[model samples]
Target chain A: MDLNTVKERAGPREFSPADDLPREYREAATRMIEFHANSEIMGAYLERPFIRQAPSIDRKLAFSAKVQDEIGHGQLLYRAAESLGVKTREEMLDDLANGDGKFLNCFHYPLKSWVEIPMISFFVDGAAMRRQATLRRTSWEPYAHAMDKVCFEEGFHVKHGEDILKELMTGSRAEQQRTQEAFEEWWPRIIQFFGPTDDKSTHHDFAASVGLKQQSNDELRDAFLDQYIPKARKHGLEIPDEPRIRERDDGTYAVEEGDLDWDEFFTIAKNDYEPGLGQINGRKQAQEAVQWVRETIEDDATTAGGHAPQAAD
Target chain B: MAALENPADLDEREREALETLLKRLADDEFVLAERYTEWQVRAPSLESDLALANNAQDELGHARLWYDVLEDLGFEEQELVYERDPADFRHATLVELPFEEGDWADAVLRSYLYDAAEELRLEALEDSSYPKIADRVGKIQSEEAYHLEHAQNWVERLADGEEGHQRLQDALDRLFPHALTLFEPVDPDVETDIVDLGLRDATLEELGEEWLSIVVPYLESLELELPVSSQVDDDTFEITEEMLPEKRGRDGSHTDAWADLHDELTHTYRDLGRSETTKIMEKPE
Candidate 1:
């Protein structure tokens, strides 16, 4: 399809693998979906340790299930990305392991303690959910289909996170104080989660024009702030003073934008931030550690024709 | 034998016997799940990560059910898990052993051995003299079927290749001794009561023999070593004491790995100085 034709047909679930589209559309969709898929993996990598560290059996179970769901989401998303035929899942995962893939700005930093868990589980995931809810109408049919399941399962995660926040806030004064400190430290990173304003975003125009991106960075950020600012207050968390947020007369919220550290943001965006590099290489070592298992299984599939005979007694 | 339907009706000796059996069941599931969570993002593939995570959660959930029964006897989560001494855990050493990096072979083989015993153990409990134990068996057995199948499937695939087969053999050799600890009695006197009172319809010896009949043949079929004499005498398999680990977890003796794991899992609870553990789900009915 020509550019104008693709533009005209850019509606919800309008395109599929059967449709022959321009290279620009396919590449754009592949880039967008691959980033989403990679974020799911890195985000899971960040939260994986907490599964072992969760204070209660119930909490540990919930953490394991949540991390599992994120990996499952990655599986779904890679298939969606691969449907574009631009890159396979193996290549995408390799790129992520090699520090060439980009993920959310929030995940680039360290999650140091249980107090900081709600910061990612509640705030950052809440922000991701807000953005993902809009993408159910994305022009790519498989991406939209994947989003449907993702949005359904993500509700449990957001609530589980909020429950953790509520528990901390209602606990002893020391626990509340520690959680508030974590919130203050993580607030700006969460704000940066939506990325730079619409006009300043590098790929926002074409993505939005082609309907791959249903909401702009500015709009998603505003929507997130409108919903979550009160949630933090309701949980007795004091909003951090920096990255000054302005509440408009229309009851929408906006960050001053100047207050957020864009230099760090851009460095993370380029996968060059020091701690972010650590996150990438840590995952790389883990991936490489298990490379033999993958190769062995692959070899077995070819030699055995994907079938193993039942063991004789 | 008549069922002991109510926790209050048990005499002191009966209570101790029931508690011993429950702890054996609960601790094994709980500790195994803890080791399984180490692979959440580190599994060989994303799909495998999700699958192993599901098995982890299932094992943890089963642990929850057993722990809830303990709560009926007036023990809470804090005392049962978070504040319990590391030496108090009654799980088998098999479940507490740490996995080597990238040891997918160990993960699958351990699951196979543990789940093989778990199925037989649950079957014995199906006709338990304790109503509570019998009541929860069906729900748990439903999930165990999937876990066993998943483990067996992975083991078969890994056993097909040269390197994979060698890894499986190495893992089995290292783990077989520890796996025998699963049948070790927490207390011989209580074990006698456990069988005499029909708390579980099978004795430790019976369960071990049954488990071997299933797993030994299966492993031999895949060209994996038995780690014990494959010889059968008079239609019975013997689990000699020589096959057992020095530190059997059921007797409250554990490897150093258990202490480190115990510290890490309870680190948050101690750090927060909280006396209570949080509960995210409703108590099982």
Candidate 2:
């Protein structure tokens, strides 16, 4: 801790490759980074439609910046990961399109309207951030740094989501109905985002052995329940399942698990479930609509007219 | 537009010049914002995506202030934005062009080229006789200053990387002619009136020349060439009145893209049916 000792330890890395580190640690970081990065990248697919399809200017513009921020966050995380020894970002994305990579279950489902955004940003993103915080000290320096940067900015997103949710949770009857329904639809999936039960094999030991994650999926889910369940109930909206409680004779309370709607839950969690079929189709239509631009890049690469002449022809 | 902070003192030409200047500023900024908005959630890189979103918001913010002026000048904010037909929109062809999806090259080139033009326009406005407009021009200029730098960063990065250099060349070849057209003259009479009123400090050619001065050096430094000045031609598919949907957009000329934008931008509001029917929490005064 002395200054001279600190200085002695400082300066450039004196040498390189002392160790490969743990495979579990390394690979988990890879999965976590790619998972987070992909989440940021594809997160927009679920958001923009709601923004573009918003029934009002204020809502449209409001959603615009948040969606943009997410896409940007994807960029930031990707660049950070690129510096790490993870899979190339291009490969990661290919994995995404192929469905080999999974996004948060919250994104797989649809946002039927603006109310969905509040639930997503607040409840879902709130859960994601809590789980994400556990990774902030990840053995992989790059991911840890990226998470540090991201967690700071994410507060705005959560607050923005909460603001919208609060407006509706207390608003007119239609607004309340819409909010309640959306919350119910989203809770389990959002809960599920902490991920499936700790397999203790692929998810716990092997995953850690390969550096796929620093925390267990169940712990992350528990963190979410710890953080949001009370808030959900406080809104006077019934928690869709029975109140998780502890039974006691002379004592007060103990924790119990409430049933989740699995049919819907796993539908989004498992790849086969296309909860947002119309949305996926809508997105594909949107993508095809802009093919000319992509083709232009490929085309420009092949031709001279494709390159801009600097002198001003 | 917000009653001028104090409106009673303006002369007629001052007001007219202000009005003319506003439409140009708003059209240019709004459409530029819209064009860049395409990259929202979809840019090839997240950093670039965020930057694009940042710039788009900047353009829209610029439009908002101009719209504020129009609202002051007696126009509804939404109508001023959503109702104009294609022919009536005076944004340069550069800002109006649809960005090909995932077209990182075009997006970089267009931003580099248009930001150059915008900086010149802002500089000209900063010297205008309209005091309030000049103040805004100054404030907007601060943000745009970074935009030029950011675009220049991408342009240089593209021009420097092995693949980047080639993409820059192709982007230049395709987008240069369009870039030059960003200097396409405004209504000549309107131009003269604007200059005479001292609301714009320079003519289109002068501003174009001013833009070229900075851009030429930057591009040359990167060894990425541009089209020859003599070969510059306007081959734009200018969206005209015919391009708009049946009833909307200036001159009714808009691509289907515009219609999609309109719906997304207005969906929530439209669901409200009438503007006055719903009320969000009023921001405290």
* The best candidate in terms of TM-score: 1
lDDT of 2 by residue, A1-313 (tens): 3333322332222111243443434455567667788787567877766655544334545667778767767767776665556577767765665667656667777667776777788887788788667766554556666677688778877877776777667766777887788777766666666655675234565544333356787667666676676677776566765435443474443234345555665565445566644444554555454444444444444564655322110
Question: Which parts of model 1 are misplaced by more than 4 Å?
Answer: A304-313, B232-234
Q: B211-272 in candidate 1: lDDT tens per residue?
A: 98888889988988876546545367878988787999999999999999999999889998
Q: Model 2, range B1-285, lDDT digits (tens) per residue?
A: 223344456667656666767887887787777677777766643445567788888877787677666666677655665444445665555566676555576787888888888888887887666566777787789999888888886676566556667767777776665566555545567677778777777886677666666676677678877543322533322323232223222222444655565555555555534332222324211
Clashing pairs in 1: none
Native contact fraction of candidate 1?
0.80
- DockQ of all candidates, in order? 0.62, 0.23
Query: Predicted candidate 1: interface RMSD?
Result: 3.8
Q: Chain A structural similarity (TM-score) per candidate?
A: 0.97, 0.76
Candidate 1, residues A10-57, lDDT tens digits: the string is: 999999999999999999999999999999999999998898889999
